[model samples]
Target: MHDRGRGHERRPVTQHVVVRWKAGLPRGRDEPWFLMTDLERPARRISEPYARRMSIEELFRDAKTRRNGFALRAVRLKKADRIDRLLPIVTLAYILLVGHVRLARRTWTPGRWCSNNRPNECSDFTIGPALLDQARFKPAAALAAIRKATEEVGEEWG
Candidate 1:
């Protein structure tokens, strides 16, 4: 298989697959994703898992940088036991942050403070930074905003 970089050595692989590009700028031209896999699964099955994995990778990227410094801080801790204990707390915080962002997107207006270029296409990853930018950093304020959003949607938060 040939890597995208010029003058790179060609490496042998079990399979080389190209999937059609889906999302991008309206007039922008982009290359299809080049995938190398060892699994014997059909192309249709492979695409689903690969797409899911990419979403998860994006989620982790947001958690580390935008939502919280989870990756940066975790690496500094010396104790394994502390790391184990910290994992659940960090996971819960991440879940709460994502949930809050999802709720806020439905409840709050993009107004003049939207960080995303396309607010309608915003997800938990995009909304988290936007929420922080809007100074909704406190848990109580965020929960209140979520409650307000749910109310607007005529849904109750249980």
Candidate 2:
């Protein structure tokens, strides 16, 4: 593969990375293969950074796929570039809704969530007022009143 740096310069390469895999349990001979061939200096350092990006990717996947949140079906973008542009906005909206729920509720589980793989499920299935108000609200306007109070506090703080 060609190595491209942040400065938009290409590097020549004549090196190979050798990796070995060994079979477990039943016992088998070790297998070795070259992962890549390169002579660029930056890639060696970038490997760790690239692996660290998986956490953010997994979060988006968990929110979109596992939690059945951030549905893109309602969006009508056609081009790949448009889809890429919309993904961040969709993710931000999902995060905002989650933040809203967490802040409104006293107890919020960070990682505990149900995996809803079905695409056609309603949004109510993933989130509802019951999620924030496990006990029935004392007054019909309690949620609305809390939201108004939060907005006033936010404005005052700003």
Candidate 3:
């Protein structure tokens, strides 16, 4: 496509990508200015669904920013390499914890939705009332009984 802003005076855009925008015209409705590279068009279309899938990103943001992540300090040296090395392990651990929360809902507080607790709750060890109820019958043997029952559950269902 021909560059719509070829002669227009504006900020210099060095990147191969261009965005289409519409501005009010003096006579009537303005036309769209298509400035995007052809390659970028497919990428933008593909990213739309992926971006929609990230609606829960805020939960991850809160966990990584508010909880145990607060203590995570930046390293002065080769940080991107370190992050590349650790990202998969971190992602796997997060996936596993999400699975755990889904299975162990009785031990968690009800929040957000029909889904499980966000990973921010992983570091929190407080057992909720329902789990406590399951823990209650053991009386003075509470801790041991809860452990045994949880173990049985793991063996049986997990």
lDDT of 2 by residue, 1-158 (tens): 55788897998657756453423412232344334535454443434434346445654554555345454455668999999998787655554554445343443342223243332122332553335445333333444545665686585344
TM-score-best of 1 and 2:
1
Cα lDDT, all candidates:
0.61, 0.48, 0.42
Tell me the deviation in Å of residue 158 in model 1: 27
Off by over 4 Å in 3: 1-55, 68-77, 106-158
State model 1's lDDT. Answer: 0.61
- For candidate 2, give the lDDT of residue 23: 34
Model 2, stretches more than 4 Å misplaced? 1-12, 18-34, 37-46, 56-67, 74-91, 95-158
Which candidate number maximizes TM-score? 1
Error of 1 at 66 (Å): 7.4
lDDT of 1 by residue, 31-98 (tens): 46656677777666667667667767876776577343446443677788987988898776766676
The top-ranked prediction according to lDDT is 1
Which prediction has more favorable lDDT, 2 or 3?
2
| Candidates 1 and 2 compared by lDDT, better number | 1
RMSD of each: 10.0, 12.5, 15.3
Q: Residue 65 error for model 3, in Å?
A: 0.8
Best-to-worst TM-score order: 1, 3, 2
